[model samples]
Target: LGYANKTQLESLVRYDLSPVLTNPGLIPLLEKEAAKQKKRVKITLKCETGTHRQGLLLEEIPEYTTLLKKTSFLTLEGLSTHFANIEDTSDHSYARKQITLFKEFLHRFEKAGLPPQRNHIACSAATILFPDTHYQMVRTGISSYGYWSSKETYLSFRAHTSKELNLEPVLTWKTRIGQIKDVGPDAYIGYGCTYRTNQPTRLAILPVGYYDGFDRKLSNSGHVLIHGKRAPVRGRVCMNMIIVDITHIPGCRLNDEVILLGRSGDERLTADDMASLAGTINYEVLSRINPLIPRRIVP
Candidate 1:
């Protein structure tokens, strides 16, 4: 459920909260805390199945098991691992290999008389792509918010199954036009003169930029939805502002609502769209949005 060190483990034990022990080094610290508290502190052991980022390696599980047996107040509650390549591509072979290794370790723990009560290895992508990997519980993240893990994930699902995956976007980034300006032909817009108008242009200034997680790479590349039409971004994206060429949309006024990543009439710009323009993934696009911004539910 969570990873903890010596200090964090002490707090978790005091609160009687079980967490995932990713390192074997923490075993002694956990034993000390459990003994001090005079209560068994249950924990899930996270084995590094393949993702070399964290967790104890498969070769170290037996050593960890031996350490667990030496403690009277430390109980092994579950086993878990994470897949590193499950979301990057359409190929599932690496993920399947991770699942196989996870299962082998789970069986090994059972043979050692440390049969974990729960075994989980699937994250959001694996949960959708490989049902067999869902041993006990699956961690649903971006997909829970109605966004596909990646384009490859969507394609893989459609190619393998006939079931409909209806996901509605839950987040809509809305901002109003801060200012409107009319420029004559040959006028260069924004910093560094990155965008120069050949024809007279009507520019709508949006009060959102890199500071709000609207990536700077979107300069002169991204588009915003306004009046049900695509308005091209002009010049460099400033720290707190961006200009869009809305010359085609007539009758535009200051304070008009702009759709940064959402639906506007018949047009829509999704996190995927912004990610593509920014040279990143949808996860970064959505997660990087400033948390200080207010959120409200809408019908």
Candidate 2:
């Protein structure tokens, strides 16, 4: 209700009623309105499949199922859960359990004659790995932007089937070199003097840093593409700048395009690559980008 505007509110009302009054805390207020209007209204209970970062637990499934069944005001429109790591075939225990619990949920609801029209359990990964679990429509996010469910998952799927649809990355992340300098051999670069060159070097400073969500942990370990070649990031990224060893790339100058998280000519830096360096994932790399940076949507 807080985030939903008039259009969304009306849309919710048109599709289902219980969602409007499922909270026991809101029951009294809803009842008062119903009393005043002399009508009865049904509601639907909405549950998070699981925390995005955390894997879904089978133990928690029954509690939510019971909650939905017990709510008098809520008319069950659907029962659903998420398979966070279904794409990762290396481990099947987690994905298998989630699927088992969802099947149990479907059985119980069907026996109760309240089987949900939408029994969604598959995300993009699940859709690719477990097609049979698609009881209803799939809820896709990353793939909608033309990215794979995950790198590991994509490889597995490709090995299994050659008839997959081609997907293209839709976003480009680029920035210009803010400054340039030539440093003598053994000169330290950036904060904490984390980088020391053995030979004379030319460095280009980029106006992006941890404060800009460039990730401080990437210092000295990450690479950015410039002039169609990979350049190592030097030292620690500061609030508004990063230093890169551009000595190998001749004719590099201030304001030249530096590919921090995108393709530059033939060289490319993917979100997954960045996340791997940061001990995270591709989702974190893209989502963690600060909102202050201007984003231009391309056709």
Candidate 3:
């Protein structure tokens, strides 16, 4: 629901897919597409309540609504906005303020007799933590995949709410050990010799690496689940390979299932765990997974 220019609008029109118009500049292009289709193209208008990134400003909403009325092809369907600081901090005051600003704009539009049929502002965090922000629909993103928007959101929800929110993780990243070897004391591993073995160490080479969305920053810091135990990463993570110390894992072998981000026995290496080690967010960890990787559903 993010159409910005004429080309995107044309494609959306050709496919008969409604998109959220983020800027007033696209209005003319939408009109042109509608004229060609000989029918009104239903579209939602995105208002910049506070984010100030995209969407019409408060003063521009009236003019945008007027433009919508002039064109026979443009039908106002919904109003939407985004939260800029909802998932970062423990305090949700800024997010609440955004909601307030959005509500004021919604009222202003209604007062102008151009009230949108559907109004949505809540993203994943708001949808789970603040139900009051749910107007007509909520845009559930990371949380839909069983990851919390942030640890703050989880804590805040638990502090205030009585309802239990059980989110089951949907994605599990798995790879197989390609090689197993033993390195003598003082042996360096991987490129640049970032890690040196202090003692005799058994290392398991995993096929998946930074190219497969494993963060390079996790080199020598991240842990993977091997035989229900934590196997520490060693040296630098290469484009297509990473070596982990598995000396403590009994009977480790080639082609053994490796848990990169999932449960193995009673141990789990979650997206959150990777995010913490990589100094990033869980969204990045999940979104950066290579699309070429096959996905299968399990019961």
Candidate 4:
């Protein structure tokens, strides 16, 4: 909402959605748009506590507070900030510093009689690690998908509480065996001759590849689930194709459902596993999936 243009801001107001305003420049624009629409626009002001990504600085907030108070249709309904060091580690000294700065900003707002009704700074990590950051609302990200924010966040949660917090992953990436073929011994597979068959081998050609968000780094080092069994990636991951060794997986055929990153019978291939094998994070593994692919929602 902070970077929203005139048209977007108008649309948000029309849709009855409050936008988060970060830039002071957007304040006047929103006022004009809301006045034109004759609609009351409740906007959340993003205060730059410590992230330094968006929001007004402490010096800038006083002036903006004056400007925001002058608007007839635009109301500062919420105040928000983001924690810079809330994730990725257990040390939270910097996050605490940011919260202290936020409290100072809140104090000023209260004195100015422009106190926002909502104050939010909790991302997924903050929601789990620090209960105090949950003022009015929480902006959860990775945890919504039933995935932990990070190993450290999970560890911190485990160390603090004996209660169980079960978060099952809801997303599953699936593909089908496009073709199956037998290869002679010493035959090279895929581009660059990266994988050579030492013995007579059976391979399953998959229609998905790095282009579809199946990471290219999974080449040779990664495995997939087929018939509830593991199939090792046979060669370099291509733009639109990947080959997996299905020699041991019996009763395999073309168009057999393959689990790229999901449960298959009693077995599962998680984004966390893919992240580790690809030398990346679970978020990247899930977000990197190509958007062109059709997504289906199931219970």
TM-score of every prediction relative to native:
0.90, 0.76, 0.94, 0.94
lDDT of every predicted structure (CA atoms): 0.88, 0.70, 0.86, 0.88
Candidate 4, position 193, lDDT: 95
Q: Which stretches of model 4 miss by more than 4 angstroms?
A: none
Candidate 1 lDDT, 1-299, residue by residue in tens: 56576778768888999889877788888899889989888888888778887787767878998999998998888988889888888888888888888888888989999998877887778889899988778888898888989878888999999999987788889898999999999999999998899998999999999999889999999999888888999999999999999999998899998988889889999999989878899999999998877889887
Residue runs of model 3 more than 4 Å from their true location after superposition: none
Task: Give one digit per residue, the lDDT tens place, for model 2 in 1-299.
Answer: 11222334344444444442223344344444444555544543333333243222344545445555544444556655656666656565778776776676666666656666665666777777667877766777677766787776788677768876677667778899889999998999988898899999999999898887888889999988888999999999898889999989998987888888778888888877888899987777888888989999876
lDDT of 2: 0.70
Q: What value does the lDDT take at residue 239 in candidate 3?
A: 98
Residue 277 of candidate 1: its Cα lDDT?
79
How far is 264's C-alpha from truth in model 2 (Å)? 1.1
Whichever of 1 and 3 has more TM-score, that candidate is 3
Choose the strongest candidate by lDDT. Answer: 4
Q: Is 2 or 3 the stronger prediction by lDDT?
A: 3
lDDT of 1 at 138: 83
Q: Model 3 residue 266 lDDT?
A: 91
What is the RMSD of candidate 4?
A: 1.6
Our model 2 lands, by Cα RMSD against the true structure, at: 5.4
